[model samples]
Target: MESTMNAFPVLETERLILRKVMKTDAASMLTYLSDKDVMEYYGLEPFKTEEEALSEVAWYDEIFTEGTGIRWGITLKGLDKVIGTCGFLNMVKQHSRSQIGYELDKQYWGKGIAREAMEAVLRYGFYEMKLHRIEALIEPPNTASIKLVERNGFMREGLLRDYEFNGKTFDDLYMYSLLRRDYKGELS
Candidate 1:
């Protein structure tokens, strides 16, 4: 089923809620975006202010409005506080593809939260979005992210040498992808 533009999708898993990010979520977003450890492989420098976090929230809105992508604030099933964000970006409708990105608060790391959240997003990308392919561009040294995607059935295609400019310098990123067929065959 393809998603319509009318409503921002809210995804649910066993223990989490992936909902549209709102202005009110800025402070929660700041918790992780401001942490150097979380931002290390994220390409951008740590956000230093709530204003920056607010701007990040605005960007999330802009992307969804423009039909470029959608980002969901990750929260526990019973809580309103966002613990992280995950979603698709750089979506190309004609190609039926998009790149996925995600990050969690440092305190929540290694708890399998990211993985559970990611599995829900992957389902949305493949089934709801009707995407043919979903990709992840991860910094090579980010073993945690690598393992997350790998566990979700994405395969490391290869390294994209000097592929992105992370503000200060060009960085190498590994390209990981899962095709619809592969996702269905392995994960369905």
Candidate 2:
């Protein structure tokens, strides 16, 4: 894994900007993280307080500082408000792989904002980070997420039976991956 230790990278797409999450973005993070609809497949309960949201922002900073992962707060081109977040986590440098995760505000669902942000992140992971593979784990029932990954050139690998315990219960996940070769081929 190439380390992004010096400066956090900010990525931009035609309609979105993927920037570092800050303390000031806590309220905006709360807007979506606290919504039941947005958190439905996210495995965590909807946040009930601003403090919970702050902790999330702190996690984003922690991952970047520790060189374990990077998360970006998603915003529109001319706006400073964060509508969502997306990033790579569980990065294994030795293995040249990382897991991708993302969520959007309910209000922004269907606008392709997540897809736009994901494309930029994917490019960074494969090109800048020099990763060979990026993975996405989605709940079996998250059809929307399944579709998104498929559209982004990810291939379904297999099911991770009872892979995650979301506090109360264990849930199975469908593993999807995009290899560097596949990503490059898509561009061609």
Candidate 3:
């Protein structure tokens, strides 16, 4: 894999900075991704070790340079310490779309940090990447995530039955999307 430093650069927001995931972040990031609650909606099992988290972030490092995906570390404005991971996954360049995913440490939930980070990723996807659409597929039971996506103007497209994750069958995934036209009127 080639370096993605040029394809994905650091993106800044009002109170946060969405930057590339770094090796140093693995220790802090594992705390969140390894939590059971955080992985509840996610298809894969909770990460059991820092090496596992580091492996995932290393994948992001390669994707960043390839212009195939943009996975960012969600950090606060004043701190270099990472509190979460948020960004696009499974980027399909030819189709001009990708799946968006995010997860923060439990402590950061309900503080509107997820929403803020999402809005920023949307901007990067729509405006910077020139993508035609961005979407989120969440398990139906994850009500908070469902609400967060809706709050950001991503329409509830439909429920896809039996989405696969981690070799287990998922009953349904609520699909949400935001088109360029949809955002043109709503982003204001």
Query: Could you give the C-alpha RMSD of every candidate to the true structure, in order shown?
Result: 1.8, 1.6, 2.8
Query: What shift in Å separates residue 89 of candidate 2 from its native position after superposition?
Result: 0.4
Ordering by TM-score: 2, 1, 3
Q: Model 2: per-residue lDDT, tens digit, 26-71? A: 9999999999999999999999999999999899988898888999
Residue 10 accuracy (lDDT) in model 2: 88
Give the least accurate 10-residue stretch of model 3, judged by summed lDDT: 1-10
Q: How well does each candidate superpose onto the true structure, as a TM-score?
A: 0.95, 0.96, 0.91
> Candidate 2 regions off by >4 Å?
184-188
Query: Sorted on lDDT, highest at the top, how do the candidates line up?
Result: 2, 1, 3
Q: Residue 29 in model 3: shift from native, Å?
A: 0.7
- lDDT per residue (tens digit) for residues 1-188 in model 1: 24347799888888899999888888888989999999999989999998999998999988888888889999998898999999999998889999999999999999899999988888888877888999999989999999999999999999999999989999999999999988843243
Please tell me which predicted candidate would have the highest TM-score against the true structure: 2
> Candidate 2 vs candidate 3: which has greater lDDT?
2
